[model samples]
Target: MVRSAYERGVTTLTLDSPHNRNALSKGLVAGLRAGLAQAAADDAVRAVLLTHTGNTFCAGADLREGSGSPAELAALLRSIVELPKPVVARVEGHVRAGGTGLLGACDISVAGPGASFAFTEARIGVAPAVISMPLLPRLDARAAARYYLTGERFGAAEAARIGLVTLAAEEGADGGTGASGKGVDALLEPVLDGLRRGSPQGLAESKRLVTAEVLRTFDRDTDSLAELSARLFASDEAREGMTAFLERREPAWVP
Candidate 1:
């Protein structure tokens, strides 16, 4: 479900689904798109904080329902990257697979010490295709390549070190307060303060310019990347690997 609240000119949108750890289902994606569109159109909303309910921020896509059609995932990712307002992700727990993609797509991210991250798509026999679009921009090239290939779990500190997260909070610090209503409020105050101090028009214009530059860069190189991902996903190896994982057996691809 999508929940929105406005305070001190900051609009906060939350993905509230404790069950399934707030997984991004098709419905959730639609809710997010609508909420973000509202935020963009509302003049009173100067900034947006995207957070989630439950212990974990999000566990990624609802795989039990099957992997989303490629077109749907691609559209969701595009909306996130093109969101007009500055979107800050307040991560409170482990963010894995598609969860990390959402965090990376945001303008800024503050994660709690307890919040670990991983790109586990390879383990599940899926390509981190759309996720790679955002993650590559947020992380160092070598770091992105390594994590995407290895699917290793890393801590918030390591994420920050690799430039995946901008800020890492200590236990009682900003993001570590947990995902309570009050905690989210406390964490978002400072971000709103900073945005309130800036020129709204300037912020919007700068974001647009930067997005244009980034898209231009991606357009020049994404054809090959997309083809590779599609091929990988369609291969026998990926099917075998995913089935092995679901069956709790060693993948044939693994030594």
Candidate 2:
């Protein structure tokens, strides 16, 4: 579900499960974690790029699986947070729920004009419990509160404005061929080039400087947050919400 390629000191991990909109299935999560490990071990690799192949960046956790550990996803985010090399999220489509955690964990994220995002857990009768560990540090408090409570979709522009995304690029602004992924490449090149210039130790220490607090919070509360997420996913209310979602009907709790 994840594909990796190395070129010019950068390792790119692409979420390739277009069939599920690259949802964070157990397999996908495992693959991503392994990819991060491989990148960390490689002396030649100076950076990592997280991107996806489908129209949707990631639809979130696979609710159909009905398993709610969220530990694996949390680990993946934590790995990104502690990765010695810089990690960049190259977003070209929508990111939802748990996917937002992946985006937030990245040291830098660039989104195309068409990209969109949302915190959708609340709508499903669950809260963004595990993801909040990373997301809270990346976004504006007020904006985070609004989106986290409302579960509303926001565009790439507003995401940038709120500090969720580092940069927002207009279509073809990267001087690409206007193809599907060229725009992302356009935004990725300069970032990768800049990353390549930094000493490995320098980059690692800089990342540690910035992520120390988030890591501490994540380490302290991850277990409880995962338990909360699992409990909510297994709750009757969330069951009704998931059922209503799949059935294309309003949930019974909706007024």
Candidate 3:
């Protein structure tokens, strides 16, 4: 579910589970965690790029995989936030729910115009508890209030304006490559090039300086948040929402 490769001081971890829109199944989480570990252990790898193979960066958790464990999801976000090396998210597709947490955890992210994002948990009768550990700190308060409540999709430009994404590039604007592989490559190269110049210790320490408070928040709140998330997933309301989603209909509680 994850593929890794290293070159020019960056280790790229690409989520490859297109079968379910690259959802965070157990296998994908394990693969992602392992990739982060590998990047941290390698002195030559100064940065990590988190990208995905399919059109959807990640559709949050795999509901078919049995609601998934919120604790596991929390741990993955924590890993990304606490990693000694810098992590950059290259987004050129849709991201939803927990996937947005990954963006919050990353030090920097670049997205193409084609990308769209949503916090869809509320529509499904749950709150964005687990992801809130990182997301609350990254997103603008007003933007968070709107998206978290409505689960509405927004464009990359809006994401950039709200600070959820570092930059958003238009199609063909990135070195005339359009919004494809070459375009993403063009967007990533300069960032990675800049990262390569920082000493490992400097980068690590700088990351520590930035992430300290957020990490503490995670340590303190993850258990309660995971419990809250799990309880919601098991609720009758969420069951109705999930069933309606799969059956192509509005949830019973929807007005």
Candidate 4:
């Protein structure tokens, strides 16, 4: 579920699926892709704000949904990568796995002080797949390799230090101030105001320049992340993990 609103040429998109911790489901991802596409095509939209509901910004892909057919997941990720407009991720809470991928794809990201990030795919016995392409650019190769391999959770400060987050908040400040719960509104206000003040053409151009560099740096090495993803989805480990999760039991893979 997503809500979109335009004000003073800025489009704000909110994820509204609090029930599943806003895990990215196929329909939700489709809506997001379509919304971003529309914003890219609309001259009136200068910048975009991406935020979510609940304490967690996004939990990740809905593993309950068959790991989403690989073809669909690749298409969705590609749409995010190719979106021409400047998109900012407003991270107010935890973001893990696929959620981290979405943030990595954004042009800019501002996070609340309390926000935490993780790449937990390996814990469940699967690779990050297409998500790794985007994430690798957001972080140093060593850091990316370490986290991707270990599935370790990191806090907001560490996230910022590692370049995964651009701004970190302190306590008691505006909701946008980078302070846990309080600084988000403040942080967004100035950023949104600045966005409104800038020329849309310049903004678009800047986005293109930066994105080009990122693209060059993190271009998908293999032709088909989806093909690899399909193999992983059907792997014995993934099958067992998914079934165990659905059945509300610990995976046997755990020692």
Candidate 5:
């Protein structure tokens, strides 16, 4: 599920399905799309803030739910890229596989020390195909190659250094300032304030400038990537990988 709340000039979309660790199940994807659509239509909404409700921002697609449609996933990422208002991601949890694609789609992303990220598709006998549209152009080529190939998980600080996130809040920081002195909210306050101050047209145009290349990538590669994703998910290797993962054992290829 996706929940929404508006404050100042930003509409916050919270991914709230912790059952599957907020995986991209059909219901969750539909909820997110509706939330984004609502934000797009709201004249008062200057930006969108995307965050999640649990320890894992998302654990990629829900393998139990058949992973949804690759084409639909591609469209969802494209919507985030083509959103007229800037989209910001606030992460204080682990992000894996397809979840990392969301970080790439956002205009700006802030992750606290609690946040970690990984392109885990390779470990499951698939490539990070569809996600590469938003990621490849933005990430450090060398780092992308290393992580994508090895399925290595990296923390928020490393994520920032590699351009996977805009900022990594201090380890001492809490998701909100509350009991902690300076934190994730502390890091995001200024940015959100700045967005609130920006003129509607200016913010929209500026967002366009920043997102154009990503949109172009979506246009040029979405079809091919979606095709690749579908093919991979349907393969026997992926079957073994998913089964091994579900059964808590090493896949045959691992030995």
Candidate 6:
């Protein structure tokens, strides 16, 4: 479900599974890992741009698909963190639950005005356990606690303010105008150009320096978090929560 394109030393990995809002189905995750692997092997590739094909960047785990293993999710997040080349995210729509993990893994992220983010796992009776490995190290403590606990939805600007995203592009304006006038693409042009300008070794080494702590967090916590996630997803509360979400109603616990 991931589509790949190469241009000017950048390999763009587009999440193509719009049917499930690019939910992290086994296929989608495998495809994304494969795309990243290819980019890593290609000397001509300077960076990776992660994007989506629909209005929602990703809706989180494929609750409908049976892969429900948080371990796989951890692996996917780690792959991005360990990737030798920088990974930049282009978020023009909504991101939820584990999708935010993908955003957190990227070296840099650009979110358009239309983008929204939420840690909706709590609503489903599960915590954002696996994702926390990548996110907590970067996000502000107070902001993370609020959103993660309440499952509140926030806009691109709020996401940027909390360090979840690097840039939140302004709303509609000519693409030619500077940051204020340009949308996501315009804001991304310079970032992409900067990546293109960096020598391969320089970019790789620089990325390593920035991502070291993220990798350390992954090494220290991945197993326990994955276990916690799996346990929650299997609990009765989570089952009811998932059913309620699929049925478009509040779970019974919602008073």
Steric collisions counted per model = 0, 0, 1, 15, 0, 0
> Considering TM-score, where higher is better, how would the candidates rank from best to worst?
6, 5, 3, 2, 4, 1
> On residues 119-183, what C-alpha lDDT tens digit does candidate 6 reach at each position?
99999898999999999999999999999999999988899999999998755455333357767
**Candidate 1 residues 1-255, lDDT tens each?**
879998877788898977778877887888888888898898887778888787788787776555655555556666766777778888878788878878867777887767888888888687677667767766898988898899899886688789888776645445444334334346556776888776778778767776674455356645655566567666777777667766889888677
Instruction: State how far residue 8 of model 2 sits from its true place (Å).
Output: 0.3
lDDT of 2 at 218: 98
Which residue runs of candidate 4 sit more than 4 Å off their true CA positions?
A: 170-182, 217-222
Query: Which wins on lDDT, candidate 3 or candidate 6?
Result: 6
Q: Mind sharing the TM-score for model 2?
A: 0.93
Quote the positional error of residue 252 for candidate 5 in Å: 0.9
TM-scores, all candidates, are 0.84, 0.93, 0.94, 0.88, 0.95, 0.96
Output the better candidate (2/5) by TM-score.
5
Backbone collision tally, model 6: 0
- Residue 9 in model 6: shift from native, Å? 0.2
User: How far does residue 101 in candidate 1 sit from its true spot (Å)?
Assistant: 1.5
Candidate 3 residue 39 Cα shift, in angstroms, is 1.0
Score each candidate by Cα lDDT.
Answer: 0.74, 0.87, 0.89, 0.77, 0.89, 0.92
lDDT of 4 by residue, 1-255 (tens): 988999888888899888788888888888887888888888888788998878899888788787876566556665666676678888878898888888878777888767888887777667888776667766877888888888788877777777787766644534444334446566677778888787877876777777775566345543466677778877989888777867888889787
The candidate, 1 or 2, that scores higher on lDDT is 2
Candidate 3 regions with alpha-carbon error over 4 angstroms:
171-183
Model 5 agreement with the true structure over 1-255: per-residue lDDT tens digits: 999999887999999998899999889889999999999999999999999998999899899965579999998999899888889999999999999998899999998878989998988898899989999989999999999998988988789999999988746443443234556888899899999899888998998898888889988998899999999999999999888888999999976
Clashing pairs in 6: none
Model with the higher lDDT, candidate 4 or 5: 5
The reply for model 6, stretches above 4 Å from the true place, is 172-179
